[model samples]
Target: MTRKHIDCRSFPSEINCSIAISADTDRELLEAAVQHAVAVHGHHDTPELRNQLRGAIMDGPPTEEQPAR
Candidate 1:
């Protein structure tokens, strides 16, 4: 199965978070990304936010180096 990833640095945020999360499935990646967003980025948990996070997910292993954001 292909791994999925969500790179925080790829998104535009005030904090410019550099954290990246990866998982075996889109569901798992979304869950971890949501937790990181809430705990570290101070974003509130909401359906809309969840949808947005889901949309941001990418296909591949998490990269060690940050891509151009």
Candidate 2:
């Protein structure tokens, strides 16, 4: 199966979060993202938040970036 990924660098953040997560399944990716959002980004764990995270899911592995601004 094609891997899925999510990148914090895609979004604008004051902390300049550079985390990139990849997984073999949606369930795994969502769990990791939820933990990151709550523990680091100070976001609450909720269905709405999970939905947003699910929306951000990418089709394949993440690519390298220049840097976060």
Candidate 3:
């Protein structure tokens, strides 16, 4: 299994936390992870959070790159 970190900034408030998951390289898995993060974490309806997750997925697994390339 692979893992990736989702960075969340803390400026106005200090609660810097990184979400680490078995790195998802596909859209479906990525979508599931994003939904889980939003529902489990307190990042619902947040564009930044969604973008960050999408970016992480795009970054791809350490052993492989996105097929779209």
State which candidate has the highest TM-score: 2
Tens-digit lDDT track of model 1 for 1-69: 998898998888888788888999888888899999999989999999999988888888878887655
Which pairs of residues have clashing backbones in candidate 2? none
Rank the models by TM-score, top first.
Answer: 2, 1, 3
Q: Let me know the TM-score candidate 1 reaches against the reference structure.
A: 0.85
Question: What lDDT is reached at residue 12 by model 2?
Answer: 80
- At residue 4, give the lDDT of candidate 3: 42
Off by over 4 Å in 1: 64-69
Q: What would the per-residue lDDT of candidate 2 be over residues 1-69, giving only the tens digit for each residue?
A: 999988998778789888999999999999999999999999999999999889888888988963332
Q: Clash pairs of candidate 1?
A: none
lDDT of 3 by residue, 1-69 (tens): 444433332112234333334444455656776776666665675778667667755343333322322
What is the number of residue pairs that collide in model 2?
0
Q: Compare the candidates by lDDT and give the number of the best one.
A: 2
Question: How far out, in Å, is residue 10 in model 2?
Answer: 1.7
